[model samples]
Target: MDILMGEPEQSLEKEIEADLTIGDLTVHEDRNEVMHFLHPVVYMTNIKGLYKKDDVLETKWTSYITIFRSNVYLSIFGVSVLVSILFVVIARSANRLHRGLDESALVVWLDASWFTLAALAKQGVDYHSQGLSGRFIVVSWWIFAIIMSTAYGANLISQLSVHKEQKPFHNLAELIRSEDYSFGLIEPSITSMIFQNTKSGSVKQAWSVLRERAKTNPEVLDANPANHFKMVDSGKYCYLGSNYYLEAYQGKDCTLKMMDSPVSWQHLAFGMPKGSPLIDEFERTLFILNQIGFVADRRKKWFKTRDPEECRSSASVKPVNFADIQIAFYLLATGTLFSIMSLLSEIVIASTKKR
Candidate 1:
């Protein structure tokens, strides 16, 4: 059997119906009326969104802070303040009970706050609380500090070590909601037919949007996969297609990424005339190939270059560059400048007092 170059599905179907060639197409319920499909050789992930990686990379200075949720930060602050207040109250009471005199309220509060902050930062503090109650609170604070510090340290290391690229939209719903991306799929394909024929849901909604867009811009219904991928690489468009086809393009262009949201699954099989005698033979051959892992081996051989493990090893971890932590340097420099100003002010005040 000679391998022929693929034509448009309509022409390909006609050729198969006329008994000219045996073609491969996704086996769908609608297509079954016109063609006999052999046992599926490839079960493909269908209708996933593809977009540019550069378009979604986290660029904000605040991205580092996203390691901890807002609630976690708030809870930590609240707990630290509560612990400081408890320490101050216990120390003040112990001082009054034992010596009949206590330190100034402001001084005790400052010392307690400093001690609490030191523990949180995993630093040593000179101050030690007196009495059993005060000691118990200190021990409890230490335990809390240990748990929080451990969690924060682990999360921070993971965030810093793994370069996580963000996604602008995770699903068709989000893609529709986002105005930044214009999405389209290869027209005259089963995936496109599924979108156009769906009666409801995000798929239907997305098709409606694309239809309207296509009226103004015919490129929205492009027949060529290359055009869809080109539009995606421009950073303003998203392409939706089968994972098998998209994965090939993604391997060629590392800048492209397929969204985690898969709209459906499609089975790819060889198509022939409705009463073709070769169907049984083809089915049996495919069954043997599937059982012996030949099909899986071919898929791995084709897609191995873009395997997640290899991709992660090649690109995910890099030495943290100065630009990555530029905000930290900015904060350090700002603090140093403020400290110098405060020192100058103190020196001026001392000179004025001498005068």
Candidate 2:
């Protein structure tokens, strides 16, 4: 038989032991440990930044403008602009040799910009340069455009192929090692005691950190499993508790997940006062129950069937939203403003020279 109970705690195990010592009730020595349960496991959930939605786990979508934010992309863009400006300067200095054209500085810059853009697009310009230096610059820029275009194409293809899912922590050891996550046990519980007395180096370290957390923030020792579930959903928290309870609570919620690796194991037993006369009778009944397969049936009924809705819903791809592209819009606005200002400055200089 299985039952779940909760109460104001002073360590339930110690309370049971104290009752046995003081003769409040008697317990069976041979049948004391009723069953074995794997140690409490950790469950973590997050709604933002690396989470599952409608069953499928995925990374946040990349914004289109984000490509321009890359240092490499910006560097290439700056080089293209510089190369265009260099062409304009060369075109002016060598204008006498190709004397048929008469154009303003702004017109020269505009033409150079168009030529540079077309070259980057792998398009040929109709205009031909008379000077050897002009021809050399054009050839060099064409080679640069070829290499950059190839590199960018390869990088963009690689980015599109990969998924960016991020997990909060893979296991208990990882949870303990990370400073980003705050972890704690259901206080005054078997799992808490196990952590406090654990011989395992990783678990022991985790316990020490948890102890410090409790001292620093007394509320870190959460008494309620329900609160633990809430904390996990709220993000950046790892709740350690019995697998039985965790499975029961998270079985319905799609977002919550238990770590595959268990942190420890425990011997779960029913307790009574020492030297109780009914111990043999209880043991006999339990033996009969096990023999008839009642225990296994009960476990299969409650624990075996996990919710499949999460799995079923995970197939659909989530739609991309404005938050993903907000930064890109900001970058575009900044670039547009800067361009308008530059054009205005060029107009002012031209007008002053005419005056």
Candidate 3:
């Protein structure tokens, strides 16, 4: 029996095969570089992404932030519906008071509104004739903008002037512009900022810190902060998280909360290893989260149980002013406009391509 291995007396290190090594990196004999997944999941998340046992694949990084643009506008949609009805009533009353409505006029007005929204949204336009749905789209969009401008102006005045039990939103700008406490956040990077006076730690900042620290303290980046919240518990680290709401300080389990309204907003989503067959699984996770009303229900539960210390600290706050709802409305409108414009641009491109 001839048994052969390393030459007799060869060091154990000689028997080890390294995947990759940089000075002291000393990667294991049979593994690729590993990254710590900092958010909760049913399984391990790989930066290289989960690939076949033998095949290595390059993957695109996708966001795990849930998109809330639709929901914010949905709130406005309900309000818009109500306002539309009120406007219809006001127009009817004005016609009755100023010039009697023949009931026939009311019918024409209703049809016009239909054409208007479709046109404003850049969908085919009101006048289908001359293929001028294109021109009608532009015209309708301007009209809608004028209408929204008027509505926003009027609301601004009311929100500023009317001090009811509901509290006038008169102090938002100052609040957002005011200095407040800062804390850790989870994300590839935080995307929004309230003007400039606040400092909520973001993934970008965290990543920068992580990168700096990695050179001297490499163990942390490999430590999974997602599955375990201890790093942040140590109060020195931030969790690059998938769910922004989890960082809320007002919740029952809100280990952290915004010192002020979020300096930025991020969409919660499961980042996939771009082009992974797990796209279906990722979508399922989003669906399940929404079905669970994870954010909404959590907000309700957290809002009511805010810490007294936090409330007191933030108590001198002027009111739930511009920084909160107003900015939300702005974002909501901006997002809608952006989506509409993108759709229109696509149509124009398609039309041009066809030509």
Candidate 4:
């Protein structure tokens, strides 16, 4: 837009002022198309330097939480199944020890999970369990339980310890809340922090403001097909989205335009609990990401059009269960060998019985 408009990127003062100077921008006809979802993900680029840094920081925090919940290990159903199995094993083991243990001691053997393991061990039978098939099974079961428990415990620790994920925040309101800023954002320019933001350039706060709106509206996501350059200049809602839009829809009628000067110099980082212990390491990773130009690399990927082939072949692609795929593949590969082994075993047993 700056090139077409034949002007370099303007300062915040110039950007806002230009809104009043420029003639009314035509709202692209397609801006009204309703979306099924609010823009869950926002790519920040293209639009002039209207984005606020506070808003970006705030949105990154919000997106971080949403991504955390989607991990398979964090699911309640997955965790609950492991817990239920643990309790069932403990109950069974207690019943096995009931025979050798005294009546009083047996009562204490109830609920022998990690908490009661020590107490149950101390209450062990004074007499050795002899010819105790049930006791043998219980001990073996506990051993197996220990092994499985150790493996899952390792997984849980890994899930928490090394955070490799870094996601973009889509809502800036969350950032304003985190930074404890004086801005309260609502539609059509409702903000209590107006005075404070005006005094100090709260570009972060401004961008976060758009993020909150994006979180609520699908129109912000793919819905912004309009020529929104003038709208942004007017500051109804400051949008900080990716420049991908320019490449995807570069034509005479498209709405996106880039700003010359940075609206605000922002330190974009993955958001988490404030003052987190992982801050240093995470910050280092962020630096590495910047050094390697990871964000720019992602920008390239984000700008690429969604593969039309995938969308076209959607119906043809069977929704195969990952577990079923493995099981079926293995079963087919070993089915003949297993059948031969079973037949041979049955023949040998029959011959032994006849002899």
* Candidate number achieving the greatest lDDT relative to the actual structure: 1
User: Which pairs of residues collide in model 2?
Assistant: 25-273, 26-273, 55-314, 56-314
Q: For every model in order, what is the number of clashing pairs?
A: 0, 4, 15, 23
* Cα lDDT tens digits for candidate 1, 1-355: 5444453265555653344233436777777786777675555556688888663344456656765666667766776786677667767776765456678889999999998788878898887654555656666666666656666676667666656676778888999998788999888888888887776598989998999999999998999888887888888788888777787778756677778888777776666667867778877888899999998897677544466754452244332433443453344335334534544454466468669
**Model 4 lDDT per residue over 1-355, tens place:** 1211211112232642221112111121121131011111123332222222221212233332332233322332342344334334433433433433333333333432332243223334222222233233234334433533444444444444433322222334333444332222222221222222443445545645556655765344333335343344333334443333433443232222223333322121122223345546655665677668786687467557444343231122112233322332233225323433444454466468669
Number of the predicted model whose TM-score against the real structure is largest: 1
Lowest-scoring 10 consecutive residues by lDDT in candidate 3?
45-54
**TM-score: model 2 vs. ground truth:** 0.45
RMSD of each: 12.3, 15.0, 23.3, 20.2
Local accuracy of candidate 3 as per-residue lDDT tens digits, 166-232: 2111122322232331122222122112211234343245345445655785544443435225544
lDDT of 1 at 93: 71
Q: What lDDT is obtained when candidate 3 is compared to the true structure?
A: 0.36
Model 4 score (lDDT): 0.34
- Name model 2 segments beyond 4 Å from true: 1-164, 302-305, 312-355
In candidate 4, stretches whose alpha carbon ends up further than 4 angstroms from where it belongs are: 1-128, 164-169, 175-242, 245-355
Candidate 2 or 3, higher TM-score? 2
Task: Give the residue spans of candidate 1 off by over 4 A.
Answer: 1-23, 55-114, 117-164, 302-305, 313-355
Ranking the candidates on TM-score from highest down gives 1, 2, 4, 3
- Select the stronger candidate by lDDT from 3 and 4: 3
Candidate 1 Cα RMSD (Å): 12.3
Q: lDDT scores for all predictions?
A: 0.70, 0.56, 0.36, 0.34
